[model samples]
Target: MNRTVVRTEDLWKVYPQEPKPVEAVRGVSLEIQAGEFVAMAGPSGSGKTTVLNLLGGLTRPTRGRIWIGEDEITALSDRELARLRLESIGFVFQAFNLLPVLTALENAEFTLLLRGVPAEERHRRVRELFALIGLDGLEDRKPGKLSGGQQQRVAVARAVIGEPALVLADEPTANLDTATGAALLEVMERLNHENGVTFLFSTHDPRVMERAHRLIHLVDGSVESDVAQGVRGGVGHDR
Candidate 1:
């Protein structure tokens, strides 16, 4: 049986506002198993990002609990959460947060560097992913020298280099052109199939939704629908 990499129970996030509180996530429960390519899809203010953030330990929930692998996130301290993220979770955001001063290879290996990976093994692992994520020859180039797509590829490579149990991506394809987005999707797809890495994305892009094995549709802070992949004539829900 595949391990459950992420589990959330009755999660909620309420932002305090004048006269009223905004409920970003309301009573959400979810389970994501190993190797699943899942997308959290919803319109704006629907809590897709909130759910992802809770899962990734980026934000504390207003109420309820989350488990990433064996760690119960709600019970952890801030420092513990930081350590957990460094060791077990990876993040890819819309902005492709690569350091301007770092080379593609350096940016890709940044997390590993934080963990004190030695030079030879770090180069080996990052170099291997450059090919997998399609950033091969550009390893020596800095972020400013790369195209938007290439920068995102470097980000993706960085996220998975340590083989984290879960990768959370928010609007991953949001800043790319059509062709570039598709190429990036293809790279992610290959990694999930071949490497058994779990991916969870929060996105509204139909292209990203279409490529996912499961679509978790959130509306007004709750699940509107949970859809298996129907595009390929195969059922792919929560498998």
Candidate 2:
């Protein structure tokens, strides 16, 4: 049986604006099972990013509850939440977010270093992942030296090196060209298939929605529709 990796109930995130409060996410609720490749799609300002932030504990909801596995993250203390995020949640942003000063290898293994994993082990894991994702020879390059696709691939390596239970990616492929984006998606799909790493993405790209096994559409801060479909080539069929 597939385990429920994420669950939200009556989720709401309201920003206090001058004229009135803006509801970024209102009464949004959903469940994502482990190992599922899911995408949340909507127009700009449709609250997809807000929902991902709430699920990742980057922001507290104005109302409602969120759970990662059995723990209710909304109830966790700030410090506790930080720890949980570090250990169980991975994030990829539209901006590659790679530190310009660090080499690709250093950037990829930074999370492991934070968790105090020994140097040798961190290198071992990152090198293996880099090879798997077609990043073998670019390890010594910094973000400035790599192409957009390479930088994004390094960012992906960083996100998954620790093998987090869930990865929340917001517009991960927005900055890449069509071919580059497709390649990145393939890398993510491989991770989801081989390592059981669950991915929840907030994307506006149709290509992304097409690759996802489950797609949730949001509008005006609410879930307009949620559907399950087969991925291209049946790579992520329901299991």
Clashes of each: 0, 0
Which TM-score value belongs to model 2? 0.95
Model 2 residue runs over 4 Å out of place are 231-239
* Model 1: lDDT to the true structure: 0.88
| Candidate whose TM-score is highest | 2
Candidate 2 achieves a global lDDT of 0.91
> Model 1 segments beyond 4 Å from truth?
230-239
Once all C-alphas are superposed, what RMSD does model 2 give against the true structure? 3.0
- Predicted candidate 1 versus true structure: per-residue lDDT over 1-239, tens digit per residue: 66888888989999999899999999998777788898889899999888888887889999999999889999999999988998999889899999999999999898899899999999999988897787889989999999999999998998899899999998989999999999998998888888987889989899899889888999999987877783321234431
Lowest lDDT block of 10, candidate 2: 230-239
- How do all models score by TM-score? 0.95, 0.95
